[model samples]
Target: MTSLFPTTLFRPAAAVVAIAAALAPMVSLAAEPFVLQDIRVEGLQRTDPGTVFAALPFRVGETYTDDKAAAALRALFATGLFKDVRIEIDGKVAIVIVEERPVIQSVNFVGLKEFDKDVLIKSLRDAGIGEGLPFDKALVDRAEQEIKRQYLSRSLYGAEVVTTITPTDRNRVNVSFTMTEGDAAKIKEIRIVGTKAFGESTLKDLMDLTAGGWLTWYTKNDRYSRAKLNADLDTIRAYYLNRGYLEFAITSTQVTISPDKQDISITITVQEGQPYTVTAVRLQGEYFGREDQFRSLVTVRPGEAYQASGVAATVKAFTDLFATYGHAFARVEPRTEVDRATGQVALTLVADPQRRVYVRRIDVAGNTRTRDEVVRREFRQLESSWYDGERIKLSRDRVDRLGYFKEVAVETNEVANSPDQVDLVVNVTEKPTGNLQVGMSFSSADRLAFSASVRQDNVFGSGNYLGLELNTSKNARSLVFSTMDPYFTVDGISRSIDLFYRTSRPYNSLGDQYQISNPGGSVRFGVPFTEYDTVFFGIGLEQTNIGATAGIPNQYFDYRFRYGPRSTSLPLTIGWARDQRDSALTPTAGRYQRVNLEWSAGGDVRYLRSNLQYQQFFPIGSKLTLGLNAELGYGKGLGGRPYPVFKNFYGGGLGSVRVFEQGSLGVIDPTGAYIGGASKFNLNSELYFPVPGTGNDKSLRIFAFADMGNVWREGERLDAKSLRASAGFGLSWISPVGPLKLSWGTPLRSQPTDRIQRFQFQIGTAF
Candidate 1:
């Protein structure tokens, strides 16, 4: 030591250095005795003291270090509710200092014209920005951004938002957001480019994409959305493929927006390839029986253009034919061979009949509103037997005809773990099949009128029909009840019965008005003779009570008086019906024809009446459908008797001719009163069109039609020249309530004495 301290300083210097080292160690030992006993916190408004102590790194009796003090400060700041944090140590005590953030007191909205106050508050709360929540700079920024997004979706591109924060008592704060929602943008136009196969107008008619239309109010298809545009493209593709344009393709599509963000436009590009024509067809398959029998069913003819629908029909027919031979497992595959050079095609048919297996079980699903018995009643074939395609197809058609479902489909499911069993699933989607209507109307002659009716196509979920109606209008009073069983017999026979009491007061402007009341009941049965034929018979009794009124035609009163009360008679009815409409409410294609005849044996006026009607629908190319309908009716009183006024025919209006007024087209008296009619005839033709820009017009149709019809007294025979003819346009829209029809009819032929009726229109009618 003496040598190190300049050994020469002195021998005493060495002894002094040794003493200092020993004393310094003793000082450190004494300082270590003063240990940290507890930790204390302040400036805690919302936070608990125990929470702060639990977060401390240095506990009681633990040595204090710089790292421990730094950790405490860091943890306090991590709470996200402090603006400042400080830690201090004094001897054996530790102190934590913090400036707590303000709490949200009451959040409110002002000048919030677009959104509700409660809704906005809830949205803020979801975004971690609401009352009772700690204030944060990052969260407030995120909330502002979210509000902007919500407004943009509503087309409020110019909307604005502003936030305000104010301090309150108890170290709390209040937040409010002010917003102004701007007007929504509207679509300007829609354009299609590079399309040749179909006209621009025609293509637009098939698309849901449009600038604006009635459906836009609900579906908002007018909005410029990518998803809607893509869907439209798919629609276009299906239109072409269904028509045998196999090579059609969509190259590209572009949607442009206006700089002002107030308008939008869409452009679609398409490539139409050469259409294929049929040149030849050959069948290459094993025919178990006579091959000639199967060949006769082919509807496809050589030299005709290839049509996908016709091809599919042929396959279906072939499969059905196989069923008659008990080969229900037969499969028919149709392949198309194309010759690009000649733009021609050849169809190759191949038949493969797998093992014939009996149907072990029939399963039904998706009939949420219909009972299983209703579906089972429509099955023509029994389960636990071999599958027959013919019966299966018929079963599907029967289910579809029930009218309780919107869609009926049969899916063949292969059974697992059972090689010889196949399951047939009949799926049906239920639709509203019951109708309830109540109406009140006011007329110049009648102060008030009311009518109510309840009709159900599916009764008790059994696919039957029942109806009751009552009308209390001043001009008409009626009570009626009816029931029908579409499938009364296992062989598809139908049964029906009707009971009614009706009274009608004729409108007579001159001398007097005639009124009569009749009460009767009838029962009938229908027996199917063929696929498109039926025979029916019935009997009934009735009583008529005529009320005499001034200006009433004496001839009508005389006939009613001739028929005795409680007239017993044997009535006979026969009818034939065949319907093949694509859709009943709005038919696009197919034909329907019916003829009915009725005869009374014992009555004041013995008579026979026959009515015939035929309707046909034909699709012109792919864009238009033409419909033609015609009806003829004739009746003659036997044994020199007078015709019944109630049984007489009345013309005009939607039922007869639209241009003419209701009950105004028949022979009239000098007082401008209508006499009974014994003969009638009607003819109508209409051309249907799709709305300018919309999807298929399944729920609505616009048409232009020509109608000609008239009624004549028994002595007055039906004549074409005497018929009243009208030509005009009309619209049919299927509303939730019922069908609404509006027509503008102008008489094609009119005379000064014939009333010269003006254009007429009507809405909400029963078909």
Candidate 2:
């Protein structure tokens, strides 16, 4: 039994009713039957008198009995509008005394970090604990328990919730909930029992859930999650089923948490059945009598180990093939017949491709931020057209590439009463596209460089990108602001605006450490030529000034003498790129090519610059990848003007010829310093392998690379024998901050005049 009154003095006098039982009399005193002359309610501040009168069982001028008194008490308590109730009869004059429950004025959350305050308020409201509602002590206690359960699901088992209530005017009160969620419980060990066919390590490798590790802090893989464990069990089942152990099963799984709730242990038991071999495969379905066409798509071969993946792949292939021809409702069913004596299985693939359907409508959903048109314009398939699976898939991928969403999926719903018509629904879940980055790094050349950037790829959900970057380095400094709209026009045309102020010093130790200051702005447009290709062209105005520094190079003084201390150029740029990579971040097999050409004809430094790059990736195995890259650059002075010294190409860095000091290749001045040249060539080959103990995580990898490149000054004869070569090993990690690369290389071919810098590490970008 719980007391209804909050005060201890009143609680002892008030009746305590058990929720599991019916209401009973609190006092033994009984009243005889009498006619009621009047009935009145008292002690209500916010509740109306009519509300109490309507709830009373006995009315005015009615005969009140003992049964009626108990009935009235039970009826009034059921309403939960009163915390205290009493009835008195003064010679046929009945009076009702009541103390109304406090009305909730506000509900607030304090010290909440794991969940948003608004979300918590909404959940409480759904549980009948909101403003203007009658507040009950029991309901408040239940709310606290529910909140604790939510934290426990997130592995925060050591969470505490405290609730407070403050009395207010008009019989109202304010409720506040404070929370403290401790650290998540982590898995200390995972043991798998009854594994005889495969090694224990091999079985564990198939699961994404693992024990504690260094990367667990970021990945949270050690946290105890029931959903993740279930998913891992499914993965294990698939692993065994794919390898001919079709009858494998997980007998039991146990999860044990430590007393302090900081460490957890997990154990799994499994059973492995006899392996089965595939005897034959046959098709048994309505394929429009095109048996031979369907047979050609089967990936499962006879006399091989029974492979569940092979059968599943063949099913998907059949379904996709049917969908291409407007059969959106096509179904493929595979039935297996086994022989215990021979340990052989025969698979019968049954498919039922229903009537061809047409798209009746296209609906977009789950995009609460982005405009509907922004998603609709990316779809290649049109409404009211025959359903095509290929275009639908491409549309989903295109939306994904926008980088505004974390997930994108397409669903087909059959139109009711219209067998030949279906509706396509596109679902997208939005993610945060705005990023504030603070970067610091140390390199051989720039000992300590600091950088910061504010970028929003989907500004205000308008599909526009805006960025501002600040770089602090003694050798190079830049302040840039840029804006780009990917869908500037209806036909997939993009527009970009860029403004930058850059200053860089020569890499050489001699020549006074003179600097070049360049301020520029450009307006560019991108036109999509095909699904995987685009062409960009831009026009920009650049102004250059030779800084006043000590020990100015004689070439700079000569250039100033000939063309003054300032030069302006109106540059025209054009570029083309075609990427067919399976993934832009970590490609295992694909081809990429890009070419850019810049020409400045209306300035004092009239020159033509062109750069080309090509890359090809090959998958050595499921876990290994090989990549080859080559780049060639050429700049020539045009219109009788010299190629700008600030625009000259340079080699001998991670991006070019590694194992040498940055920009330490090319022609030498009179002071034994290597100045940048106008011609550059580079070739790189790398073999990437998985990181040890990381399984199939592509974000972390190790690679052995061989690099060869060189630089040549303008008017200097190009020689193949002058090229510098290096071979090394490097580690790459796509960390939370950014992509990090660390390399250690030894120069294989270096001349006496070359500067060597062996170790290099960089964050936030790839070389």
Candidate 3:
């Protein structure tokens, strides 16, 4: 049957060629005249005759051969205005007939629930099928296929499409594509076949592709895609190669479907060749100068096993070292010699520092969404100057730091016209920077709380930020509007202004609580001290009002008598920070430090508060990273007075320590409830590793974490040695949408009153 299929497919091609040759003889045998005296078009709606005549291959009084007629037919068909085309000759005159496809009166949709109707319409228009336009069978077929693809992308694999073609009274047709989108196919089980060095569970864990999990319902990673499978295979190949399996090869990969077409299984056959150890490494060829300096850059040891990562690192280090000496055209290639019998490998690195070329022009390409200045400003290696690899890398990093583009890359191309000068092409891919968050929470006393906020990080692709946030819930009310210009001055000084109002009901489980509201605004200015550091100063004014409310905790509220609707207070704030994390979502190596101090001279709640946080990351080996974070904060009233409730820090949930209940990490009253106060300390650490089966070495990582942090009253002295602690394990996947995180933490110092949290999962998290 398989052999017959290929033969059947070739039959039509053979027949067409044979017919064309056979028909040539009949043309010679025909008695018809060869020349036309005049030409006229019989049918053409909303089309000019001059246009058709101009398109004709043969002029009037010219020979009308078979080729000419075929050309005429093809020309008319290519216009996309005709439903049918025919050329008839009578004596010496030729008649052109065309039944033009109707111009669309209007294209619209009603009750569109599956896809955005306007977006669909735009796609159809781009496909040459839309309202107020002529159409052909080819266009209709293409439109249907495109619509199906869009639906499939949305996971509507079982969707059915029906087209309706209705002719109107005015020589027009109204085309409608009605769709019945059925439910999507949910993945049941993902199985990998063939011989394996690792177990199925271990292999599965290494895959970014999953069967079904909590996020699967949304991200649909479980859905099958051939492109995704190929990418995953490359990931698997990298994993083995980096681990010293130099001879690993994937023989074949197969994706099978059941009769129902809803279930799928993937099987990959791999040849796990014997692992090799590095016996020797030799550097040959020109070293330009300072051979010792280059030798120091070598991280691969002679006796160490062959690792792809080490090989790449050596290449990069060599290249950068050459660039530092103005050798931008340098090339370094590592050739491996493998001994099959002994399973040993030898690496020889050859360096050729070619004629150094200066950059004559730096061109920005493929940036349709971003302004030219936004990208050009990040250039550190200026044109008409010698190229420096370090500068180029820094320029690329600067562009990526804007957060406007998902990916930024630089390609060096030798200018064809000029050999001594190279043209640098900066490529950028933009991502959606607008975010909307709407969520609701329910508690025993607070029936249901709702909160929503919207912000745009990259406004107009200029790298500016604007946000209008609103949070209205049971105990908290806030409205904040802010704008930030990252490049307010050409010197890189950023300025920000914030307008905000907030009202809070300081809740206490006991019957002595108070209702306090603070409403105000602020203006801040920031200065970039260095590439990894920034400092900011701000001043704000707020009016505070405090009132007693029943049902508040008596032990805390009675002592803190209500006093508010007080005069305006001048509050000052100063902040400094630096971040060097590899990834904001999951740091591999770097340090992040921040310190902020705020003080209010006048208000119902006046106090001096300071917060300091520091995070450090280190690479344990090629495959693991260790991260540590610590935070300390304290608040003290200027005069002999009580600590401000608003200055208090609450821990728990995703951002804080994840083991305890939300808002339950702070000081508690007799009822074991959170009472507003200030003074806190926290410590956390995590060890991250690549998930076993996930072919992605960088995209997915698993971590075991320990968190130790808590909040205490401001009047009470803080005991750093007595901090609360929580320990747990979690998974981190660098998903396309964001970082997907899931952790289950348990309190290390469990008290009788502490609530234990388990199986806690969060999507799109940042640390």
Models 1 onward score TM values of: 0.69, 0.79, 0.76
**lDDT (C-alpha, whole model) for all candidates:** 0.72, 0.83, 0.73
Candidate 3 lDDT trough over 10 residues, lowest sum? 1-10
Report the number of backbone clashes for model 1. 7
In candidate 2, which residue ranges exceed 4 Å CA deviation?
1-143, 146-189, 212-220, 256-265, 289-293, 431-444, 447-456, 459-461, 554-558, 618-624, 672-674, 687-703, 715-720
| Model 1, CA-based lDDT | 0.72
Best candidate according to TM-score: 2
lDDT of 2 by residue, 153-233 (tens): 778999899999999888899999988888888888889899998898887877767788877675667778899899889
Model 3, 560-589: lDDT tens digits are: 555433545678999999987777766678
Give candidate 3's whole-model lDDT: 0.73
Query: Any runs in candidate 1 off by more than 4 Å, and if so which?
Result: 1-193, 196-206, 213-231, 238-246, 255-262, 273-352, 366-371, 429-435, 440-449, 487-490, 560-570, 603-605, 764-767
Angstrom error of the Cα, residue 340, model 1: value is 4.9
After best superposition, candidate 1 residue 467: deviation in angstroms?
A: 2.6
